[model samples]
Target: MQSMTGFGRAEHADDGLIARVEIATVNRKQADIHFSLPRELTALEADLRKLVLRFISRGRANISIHLERVSGCDDSFSVDPDRARALETAFNKISDLIGRPVALEASDFIKAPGVLTFSNSVWDVNEAEKAIHPALETSLKNLVQMRKAEGADLKTDFLKRLNTLETYSSVIGKATSNVVERQRELLHNRLREAEIEIDLNDERLLKEIALFADRCDISEETTRLASHINRFREYLDSSEPVGRSLDFLCQEINREFNTIGSKANDAGIGQSVVGAKTELEKIREQVQNIE
Candidate 1:
């Protein structure tokens, strides 16, 4: 399983353009793709989104692409005549208003916005897309590699907690033994102390105690919890994204843990269940970020 949160960046330096692609991801219940690109590249958003989704099956992803001409790609430069004229007119008007003769220098024209321009060699969007693929692939590969490392660590932590849960399940089972008999003894002693003569040999008494014990039994819950754990481990072995499904499985495990805690009334069993539940809750917290 991979983590839903990660980052990847790729740069394609080809021809006269330096195209940079950066991707940031965060934990989310569903797949979401957002992009920041120049207006010219906006048309490619759908294709980029599809490519990103292929690498990331679950997460909210932020993708940013920036393109700029590098020195070797196209070095041709020119002045925008209209913009230069506009800037010169503004400077001359300002000088006249200030009652002074001012020289409109080359620096002034160069400093003005839109005064300088470059003519890029016409290029197809498809070629740029191909060049970006390698960089994009590298970035995603790095992100997934990190998530795999993290997932391995998460698996280790889960195994330790699962063992704890199993140990507590056993304790609950052991603590349940003779519990109804003990409750019967207590009730009999209390009645005798109160000077109330109640027949302990009645089948009704046995039936009542047995019914109470059955109500408190957590065996079914424990078995289901075990099954869920096994299934979860199996998911970790697969290459596919499992964040959403694992989240549901974690909830099921927590529900089972809660059920065991509520039904097991023996103090030892209850305490153990509480501890196990705490561990499960921690595991569940991590599940939200799992992929």
Candidate 2:
């Protein structure tokens, strides 16, 4: 089992850029990615998306990247005569207006267009691909490790709840046996409280007890809940991502517990059903982390 929430950060030394990437994931029903990268790296988006999908099955992921490529590191820039002339004229006019002498220097010209340059290889598909692998691999591996650790904790908590559920199910079973006798005792108490002579062989009493017992009998729900628990644990043992399966089983368990709670009139049975429901709710929440 693996959790869908994790965070990872990686940095790689590119030709002139130290490429940094950070990934954070949160649980979702489907795999969705949000990316932030430099303009020069846009061409590599598809490949990065594929890589992310390979590692994650269900999560909403945010990927952020920072690139620090040295300016004018590759090829020398050429001056644009028109841009330099315009800047030079503006500088001279500004100096004249201020009644001051301003030096027309290379530093002033550096602000002109095309003064700084970029490598032709900056947009190279191959270069981008090459730089991608290292950072991506590092980030993915760390993300997987973090998710695994989180899943281990979730598994421990889930197993404890499962044990609680098992104990509660046993209590409910034992409580179920005396329900018929309990109803009879309740009927006697009610009649005495009303100070009425009750007929032991009353047809209405017989029909009502049978009806009540039929309504309160949670054998069907108990059987189904046990079967669902078995399947739930079985899915957890498998290698495949079982979030959906676990979610489905949680719904089944919740439904059965709800029925048991409604059908049971005995205080002990009701309390046990409530315990089972509480554990089932915890199971449901833990399932959100599974992937």
Candidate 3:
């Protein structure tokens, strides 16, 4: 099992370029990949998405890539000679028209638009990709490790709650054993209180009691609930993605518990049903984070 929540980051430096990658993931019903990359590296998005998909089958994954030029590179600063010369000529003309030696500062020309520019070092796409791929691989590995650790914790929690559900189910089964006899006694007491005379061995009363017992029988539900629980445990031991499967099993379990609660009319059975339902709900919540 693996969880859908985790974070990882990695950095690599090659030649005069540095590459950093960060990966984050959160639970989702389907697989999704979002990337934040520099314009120069936009073409790598498809490859990055494919890499993430290799590790995750379902989740919302966010990947970010950052690249920077290291110091002491061959890049240099240069002045646009044409723009600078034009500015200098204009300044000379202005000084001549004023008939005074107007001072012109080199800083003024440097500040002029387009006068000075840095010559960025040419980047080879293949080299940049080579530098980024290793960092991306490391990040993904770390992410999977974190997700697996979290999954182990979630599995432990689920097992504990499953035990709780089993305990409650056992209590309900015991309480339901004499449900028919108890219902019959309640009917007799009601008749006595109403001062009505009816034969305890009347055929009509016996028939009614038999029908009531059939209506309230929960043995089938209990049997099905036990099967569902066993299937759920089997899924937990599976190595493939089991979130959707576990979610479906939770619904089945809940349905059986609901049937048992409605059919078993004893107060003790009702309380046990409530406990089982509570534990089942918690298990469902935990299952949502599994992949």
- What does candidate 1's lDDT look like per residue over 1-291, in tens digits? 788878888787776567778888888888888987755556777877777777888888887777667765556777889998888888889999999988988888767866875555334587567666666767778777777888788878877877887787777777777566778898788879999887998777778777888888777887898899889888877788887777798889878877877776667777877887888888888888887
lDDT of 1 at 55: 84
Give the alpha-carbon lDDT of every model. Answer: 0.78, 0.81, 0.86
Scored by TM-score, the top model is 3
Residue pairs clashing in model 3 are: none
TM-score, structure 2 vs. true: 0.78
**Which 10 consecutive positions of candidate 3 have the poorest summed lDDT?**
117-126
Give the winner by lDDT: 1 or 3: 3
Model 3: what TM-score? 0.82
Ranking by TM-score: 3, 1, 2
lDDT of 3 by residue, 1-291 (tens): 889999989988887788899999999999988988766667887887787888899999999988777877767777889999888888899989999877779887778877876544235677788778888899999999999999888888888888888888888888777888888888888988999878889887788899988988888888988898898888878878999999999999999899988888778888888888988999998888998
Which ten residues in a row are the worst by lDDT in model 1?
117-126
TM-score of 1: 0.81
